[model samples]
Target: MASPTAAPALRAEHLTKHFGRTHAVEDLTLEVAAGEVFGFLGPNGAGKSTTIRVLLGLLRPTAGTAWVFDAPAADVERAHRYLAHVPADVALWPSFTGQECLDLLAGVGPGTDLVYRAELVERFGLDPGKRARAYSTGNRQKVALVAAFATRAPLLVLDEPTSGLDPLMEREFRRCIAEATGRGQTVFLSSHQLAEVEAVCTRVGILRAGRLVEVAGLAELRRLRRSEVAVELARPQPALDALAGLPGVADVRWTSPLELTLALTGPPGPVLRALGDADVVRLDVREPSLEEIFLDYYGQAAA
Candidate 1:
């Protein structure tokens, strides 16, 4: 369990980064609490990678500060002692075998549980005897993931770690993250996979055009989503002018003389009452998925 008095695992205060005339990340401020799994989300070109580079001390911030385990990010050597990082792209010396790569990373990282590392290698279905040059993209990713998960560092920073993984491997990745958090390790997960984030993160932050647009728990975000509703009338339906005017109803359309489809965004009371007046034969309400909600945010940002 994380100590209540322990400082946050990661913190950014008014952080910004720029390249020539372009602002990559602008005035971003957020904190990842000890033992928290935070999802950092953004569309491509939204500064997610830039913000991470600053946090890793690979790039000096144009303004403000980033800290890891209470040490300034600029002090990479010290700050890195408390964390393990897995980048979107994994590169390895072509001559080294998978086992050799794991050994090398463990030797340089904070610390490693060799026993657990062995288990991860098996679970990820990696052939440790293969040389790096022969490994496929997914297999190379597995090597990096295994190395990071085997570490005893208090924080894990993953940037699109599952990009090369197949569905089964992605599930294994989520399981590993769960186990890490269970051991009181903090996780900063930057991913474009909304379903993955929805499955694992305790909270999520959405970024757009170098700015932090919103930060909220999954449940809170779900509340803002619209539900898809399809209703079938048993008989010729009454005109739906009143239903169209209902507070939360939108995109009302009659697909056929007996069927109506609409989107519901808020309280269902009024809409339900209006539906009750019709000769309702069947009704289906499907909740919006995380991907839909994410796209909604992106669309709104674009507009």
Candidate 2:
């Protein structure tokens, strides 16, 4: 359990970063509480990576400040003691075997749990005997993930951590994230995979072209959007005509003699009331996918 007054695991105050004349990240202010898994979302050129670099103290923010565990991020020695990180890609020493690389990473970071490292090695299906030169992209990624997960560090910063992983390995990664949160570790994830983020994140922060445009919980974002619905009836009931005029219903279309699809926003009460007396053989409602919710925000920003 996190104390209500606990210092944030990560914080940035009106943070901005620029390269020459181009502003990569601008006026970003955010806070992530202890033990929370936050998803950082953006497309290419959206400044997601730049923001991460500032948070890691790899790049000095052109303006504002970022802190980790209440230590200024620029002071790497003090701030880094509490975190472990795995970037989108990792290149290991050609001569070292996976085990050796893990050992080296562990040594350089805070103390790691050797026992848990062994377990993670097994869970991720990584073979430690292979030298880095023989490893594929996915294998190299595994080495980094295993090291980060096994560390007892309180914060894990992962950027596209599942890049080269197969679907099966992606499942395993999600499991690892669950365990991390269970142990009260905060996770800052930057990824392009909507499904993965939707699976493990408690909240999502969306960045659009170097700016923070929207930040909200998944359910809250969903509430602001519409749902796709398909309905099947025993017959072509006349109630369908009435539903077209009902509040929060639009795009009513007949796909077949017995089936119809429509977009519904807000409460389903009006639609349900209209269908109350009809022979509804089947009705299915699907909340918008994460990609759809994301676009809704982007669309708002663009307009």
Candidate 3:
């Protein structure tokens, strides 16, 4: 097991991939430190898969390069010793049983460790004798997940790894990830589940239109965006509409005779004072959701 330390497990420098005239990933640069789970998030057609393929050496980059544990992705034998990848649709031989698939994956390397094999079967609730064809998509994914996690590999790249999993299985996946990080393993998780990313990743990069739109810690990203503050006033004063034009207030809406919703972008102090002067029954302040944040970014990108 690698010591939990501050070294980059993966690094991409000015990586660009093009499919004809279309740019799939443009000048993308990022790093995943050892023992950290760096979440890659984007909407459909955002080049998440393209970037993963480049990292896994499944595709060659048009420009720049990607490194797995300081070695080029093109070196399969070297990468096999240090990194593992789990795809969205995990494929296994239908004729074989779950245990057979596990054995084959373990045979990939002489240094492979199966110490966690029995524990993972029980943990993920997988039956070893079940035929691969009989297993659900989630079960097949579990087989891949268990195989990747049971190894001593320093890096694990998972693209939509939990797509077919149910809630219970998702929880188990998260638990397994948490345990892996504790053992100093690095995980590069590409997922649409922002809540999951928010829960597990220490840092994240947002992709839009094949470009890196933003990269920041979760807390920092939240601070840069405005939250919606809804207030139910005890009295009505249409004059409060004046606050709409103030700085840091993006928009405002009147829900009823006394309820109003305001988009606040700055410190809440000034907004709170304005509400106090207007009189209110109760107030609610909520940070914008990940979806909302992305939508706002999209709007800006379009404009």
After superposition, the stretches of candidate 1 with alpha carbons farther than 4 Å from their true spots are 1-5, 237-240
Model 3, CA-based lDDT: 0.84
* lDDT for predicted candidate 2 compared with the true structure: 0.90
Instruction: Decide which is better by TM-score, 2 or 3.
Output: 2
**True lDDT of residue 146, candidate 2:** 98
- Tell me the TM-score of model 2: 0.90
Candidate 2 structure quality by residue, lDDT tens digits, 70-184: 7899999888888999987788999999999999999988779899999999999999999999999999999999999999888999988999999999999999999999999
Error of model 1, residue 267, in angstroms: 2.7
TM-score of every candidate relative to the true structure: 0.90, 0.90, 0.89
The runs of at least 3 residues in candidate 2 whose Cα sits more than 4 Å from the true structure, single-residue gaps closed, are: 1-5, 236-240, 254-259, 297-303
lDDT of 1 by residue, 132-157 (tens): 99999999999999999999989999
Candidate 2: which pairs clash? none
- lDDT of residue 156 for candidate 2: 93
- Clash number for model 1? 0
